[model samples]
Target: MNVPAYAGPSSVTTRSGDALSLPAPRQDSEFSIERALHERRSVREFGKTALTQDEVSQLLWAAQGITSRDGLRTAPSAGALYPLELYLVVGMVRDLDPGVYRYAPAGHKLMKIIAGDQRHKLASAAHGQDCVADAAAVLVFTAVERRTTRKYGSRGVRYVHIETGHASQNVFLQATALDLGTVVVGAFEDDAVGKVLQLPEGEVPLYLMPLGRP
Candidate 1:
């Protein structure tokens, strides 16, 4: 498919330390939606191949990239609050230091949160799921309930979850298109995940997706 290119600012680190820029996401893809859907599977095993920076960019874009000048994302959000926040637990991505990076969707870049690979800890929090440690990277989806809760009240809780589902499905479809393997891991200890990622006080972990070459 013919997709538009991003003619925005180049990726740059805001400060010193491990913070680094990510490659711009490629808008075009030859992969067909029908084929991706047909091939999509909950893959638990992954090959040792390291994911490229472009693949990482594309996956993050699929999850929460801005699709228009107005900043509409690939996934739908309740009341357009966009409560979901994406984190990358890196292990084996090319040209990227292993660590936890937060996805800055507005900038289409990543901000380093914690340095060093934490895949093993994440796998432990995920109840010994090898995929968490084996995959090149794991996408951790979290949410700030107050962003939607204040607008929708208690029902906003459900909306945040639904939004996460939409984002997770986008990752699955994108992984399929890229010939990568991934699985949605929801059976993790919430507190453990929070501690491992050192999440902000208000954000809470909702879903974990481990992705790599199949």
Candidate 2:
């Protein structure tokens, strides 16, 4: 992982190295969840078209951003004990460093962890899925067990998994609306991913969704 001294421009200024542009917000009349669901498919092959940082921000926001003044997320957590932690495994996203970054849901920002093209390693870790290698970005759904367990006891673990599904669905629909492709990947070595993302012991990988232009 190459961490350049400057490490390029911040995520805000560089929109995939192209001129800064914003994607049109999902309009009530234009973008419908039902429509996106109908159009959603697991796209394994992708064009080399790069995704912008703004696009990533919006996608992450939809996945699990704070939706209220009290730090409630987009998905309902059991007892409001939000346990799901989002991580982005960026590959081809333009203008951003390639690496794993934890998604800070409260502030809606990427906290860079290991930097530089770790996607190839992730691909190998994911049982040699070329999509993991080629994706513009991969969103990892991880959970800190005790966040929910502390509230609901052992059964809280079940609720946490359900919450993760809700978040992943949100990403799927949002990506579909953006005309991007996404596929949910569950087969992988959890320990390997945790090491790659530098997650703590209790933070467990629950799901992986690789995203890119179809």
Candidate 3:
């Protein structure tokens, strides 16, 4: 992965070329959990409007942002060995370049792994699901099983899957609250996805959630 760090004009670029400084996640909102749950549904069709930077920030925060001072994430991990990694496939987000970005939850920042719209390739990797390309952005979830397996034995695999469900659900409810449409797509060739993103070693792609306006 290319390491050229970047930052929006508003913030100074650090030595790591951290792409964008994410807006602080809102802690309170008028949207309630009950409503989000009731309205939540898989959205395959999306509008052409580009999503705002804040929206992108919120979704990443929901997925796996730091929620506490103790380093606990939004999702519970086995032995607190957070092994999940999030990648944002930006297609039509406002003030953001199109590219594959690695989410650094610690700084609430994104590091561009590569540039260009890889959504169509992702759609192809996902067996021609157009939604993969149509959406404004996709939040890709990957995991390092060894982080948990080292301590919990093979049962750690089960824990990681369970944590994925928790984290993805957070994405679902957060999208609903933000009035954004999204779907968790699991049907894809793992190796194909790995190749498309040129994922680093030991990072296994798990879920693909495309987000957009309905």
TM-score ranking, best first? 3, 1, 2
**Clash count, predicted structure 3:** 3
10-41 in candidate 1: lDDT tens per residue?
Answer: 32334344445566777768889899999999
Candidate 1 positional error at 15, Å: 7.9
TM-scores vs. true structure, each candidate: 0.91, 0.86, 0.92
| lDDT (10s digit) by residue, model 2, range 82-189 | 888888888766577677878777545667777777777777778889988888789899999898898789999899989988988888888888888889989888
The total number of steric clashes, by the backbone 3 Å criterion, in model 2 comes to: 1
lDDT of 1 at 49: 71
In terms of TM-score, which candidate is strongest?
A: 3
The positional error of residue 68 in candidate 1, measured at the CA in angstroms, is 1.5
Q: Which candidate is the best by lDDT?
A: 3
TM-score of 3: 0.92
Off by over 4 Å in 2: 1-29
Ranking by lDDT: 3, 1, 2
In candidate 2 the C-alpha lDDT for residue 55 amounts to 67
| Local distance difference test scores for all models | 0.87, 0.78, 0.88
Worst 10 residues of 1 by lDDT: 1-10
Query: Per-residue lDDT tens digits of candidate 3, residues 33-111?
Result: 9999999999999987777778888999999999889999988888999989999998887778788999999989999
lDDT of 2 at 17: 28
